[model samples]
Target: MEVRLTREQVLALAPDAASSKAGAGLATDGKWGLLGADAEALWGECQGSGSKPYQTQVDLAGLVSRCSCPSRKFPCKHGLALLLLYAAGNPRCVPGTRPAWVDEWMQGRRDRAARKEAAAEAAANAPPPDPQVQAAAAAKREASRWSKMEAGAGELQRWIADQFRQGLANLGNGFEQDAQRMSARMVDAQAPGLAALLDHAVSGGGRDLPSLARLGERLGLLQLLTQAVPRVESFSAARQADLRAALGWPVDRETVLREGEALQDAWFVQGQQLIEHPGNLTERRVWLHGVASGRAALLQDYSHGGRGWDQQWRTGYSHSGTVHFHAGTVPLRAVASEVQGGTASAVPADDTFDVAAQACADNPWLPQVPMRLSAVTVAHDGQRCWLQHGEGTLALQLAPMPGWSLMAFAGGHPLCLMGEWDGQVLHPLSAWNAQGEQWERSSA
Candidate 1:
C-alpha cells in the first residue's frame, strides 16, 4: 500500500508516551521477523519473551490494528511498531500476499462495517414515531434533567460560598477529597459540565496566587451559572442553549445538523492539538479559519481506548466544507458535515490579541480562542519564549524543545504564527514563514 502517513502521524496514533517510545525503539529491523505489506494491510511477527513470536497487523484504510499480545490497550506497542516501520519505509516491509490470519481479520472488519451501515440505513427508513408523543416525552425528560441540574447548581453555589467563608487556605488536607466528592455529586446530579469545572479547579493549579486566582474565576463563573439556572427562561434562545450546554446537556449530532447555524466556506486548517485525559481518552482539537467569512471554527474529536480518531486534518491546507456550528453565545465549535478535497493554502494570519480579548469578553467561560499573529518573531529571554508582534509580546506556553524549534525556524526574522490563546498564555501550534513554509508542532 502507498503509505502516505508521516512518521509523526504514525506516532500520533500511539495510545501513550510509553507506547510511542517503545514503538519507535522497535521500528528497527532487528526486532521483527517476516514484515510484509500489500494494498490492504501490513503484518509482521514481533519476537517477544514468549515461545512464539507475537503476530501484529494493521489495516491501512481504518488505521486499526489487531495483535496477539495480551494487552488491553488498542493498537498495542507491537502494532504501533509495525506501522512505524512501514511508515519509515523500512526495507523489511516488502510487498507480499496477505497472511490467512490478516485476511480473515480485515474481512471481518469490513463485514462489520457494512452491517453497521445497513442497520443505520434501515433505521433511517423505518416508520417515523408519533410527533406529539415523541415531543411530549422529550419535553418531560428535559424538564426532569433541568430540575436535577438546578438542584445541583444550588448545592454547588452553597459549596462555593462555604469555601469563601471558610477561606481557601483553611480547606486543609481534605481539600482534594472534598473536591472529588463534590465533582461526583455533580455527576450524580447529571451536571457533568459542572463536575468538569471542579475537576479542572483541582488539577489546573497549585496553591500559588495565579492558580488560586484561576480557581476563583472558575468558582465565580459557576456562581453565575447557578444563579442563571432559575432565570434561564428569561434569556434568549441562544443564551439558553449556551446555559444548557454549560450544564452538560449536549445537543445530538442530528439536532445540530438540522437546527444549528450552518456556514459554507473554504476553511483553512490552522492547527491541531491533542490532549490526553483520564481513562485512556484522548481529545483532539482542530482549529480552522473560514477564508470567505473570516470566522474561526473548532472541530473536536475524541478517541477512547486508543481506537484513534476518525479523521486526520493537516496544517497548511484548506478544505471546502460546510460547518454546522453548535449553539453558543460565541459560535466556535462546529461539526463539518461535508468536506471536500484539501489543497495547499497560505496561513490566514491576520488576528491580534484584541480579537482573543473580545472573544473572552463575550464568553468568559470559553477556555481557548484561536489567534493568528502576523509579522511575529519568537523571542527567548533565557527563561521562557515569547511571541513578539510589533511592539506587543505574549508569553508562550510551550515546551523547551518546541520553543527552540520555533525560534530556530524564525532565524531572527518575522513569521506568521497560529496558536490558541487561553487568556494568560499563548500555545503556538503552527507557524509559517514569509515564503509560506509551514512548521507544525511536533507530535512527539
Candidate 2:
C-alpha cells in the first residue's frame, strides 16, 4: 500500500521554519524534473540553482529522508517538498518502480538494520558473565567515581558560598564566563548533572530580577545536591538513585529493564514536546497516561545532527505495553517495551492542583509535572494566554501560533487539556474536544 500522510504531518517534519516555507514553495509540479512514489518509498529530482537537479528520496516505512544536496539539515527542502507533494496527492507523484539510487539506499538501510538485529540476538544468546566478578568491578568503579563527585560537590559548595558573600549585585562583567568555566570544571569532576545545573543558573545573563531569582533557585538546588551527595549512602535505595541521578549518574537502560520497577498497562499517548538545544541536539519528551492505573509516565529520547527518533508515538492513540521506570523516589521516566498499538481511549481529565502539589512535595527536584484538566477553556488577556478551569486559572507558556491554534480549536468552549506544569506556568501539549478529536500543540 502507498504511504499516506496529512499536510500538517508533512510540515511538522520540516527541520526549521525556513525549510518549511521553502518546501511549500517547491511543492508545485513545475518545480520538479521527475516525481514518483511506490509503496515503500518516494523519489524525486528538484532543479536547483546548480547545474544538475538534486535527487531526493524518502523511506515510507521510517519516514527517513535523504537528499543529494549539501545541506546538513535532514529532510532538506527537496525531500520535504517531495513528501508534501505526495501528501497532497498530487498527480505527478504517480506509482513507479524504485530507481537504482533509491533501491541502493534502501538496501543499505535494511542491511544495517539486519546486522544490528543479529548483534543484539547474539549478545542475548551469549553466556552470562560471572556475577561475583562483575559485582566487584562495578563496585570499584562506583566507589572511585563517588570520591571524585564528592570532592567536586565540596568545591561547588565553596564557590556558591563565595558568590553569596560577594553579593548578587557584584555579579557583573565576567560573571557569565566564570560560571561557564565552573561548569566545565564540574564536567571534568565527573558530575555532568551539576554542570548542567550551573549552565542553567547563568543561562539568562543574570541581568533581570527574574533571571537573578532563577539563578538563586538553581544555586539553592545545587547546594542541596552537594549536601546530599556525601550522605547518599544513608538514604533508601530509591532515594539513593534519585540523588545519584541528580549528581549526573544514571542507571543504564538494560539495568532498568532488568531490575527497575515495571508496570504493564494500556497507555494513552497524551502529547509530546521537542526541545532544541545548542550543538544541534534535540530532546523529545512523550507523555503517556495509564488507562487503568491512572499513572503518568514520561518517555525521553534524544537525537543529534539530522538523525530522527527511533520510534513515533502518535498523540490520541493507545499502546499496550510494559513500562520499566528508572529507580527514583517518584518514578516518572520510563522505557516502554512489548508495546502494541491499540484503540485510543478517553483520558479522564480529572487531575487537580493538589495532585501536582503533592508530586512537588514528594520530589522537590522534579522539573515538570504532567497534568490533565477537564472542562478547561483557553482565555487570553491581551498579552498572555490562560487556561481557566472552574474558579481557578493557570498561566500558559505558549507561543503566539500555538496559542491562536488552541483558541481556534476550542472555539470558546471548554476542552480537556493535557500539559506539563512547571510549578508556575502550564505548557500545553495537547487538547481534546467534546467529540474526542485531538489537537496537538506540536503540530502548531
- Per-prediction TM-score, please? 0.82, 0.81
Residue 291 of model 2, lDDT score: 84
What's the residue-level lDDT of 297 in candidate 1?
95
C-alpha displacement of 89 in model 2, angstroms? 11
lDDT of each: 0.82, 0.83
Q: What's the true lDDT of residue 375 in model 2?
A: 88
lDDT of 1 at 78: 90
Please write out the lDDT profile of model 2 over residues 255-290, one tens digit for every residue: 889987889999988878778878978788999888
Compared with the true structure, what per-residue lDDT tens digits does model 1 show for residues 200-295? 767864787777777887777778878888899899987887788777887788888898899999998898877778887878889999999998
Residue 58 of model 1, lDDT score:
88
Q: Which ten contiguous residues of candidate 1 have the minimum total lDDT?
A: 305-314
Alpha-carbon shift of residue 48 in model 1 (angstroms): 11
Q: All candidates: CA RMSD in angstroms?
A: 5.0, 4.7
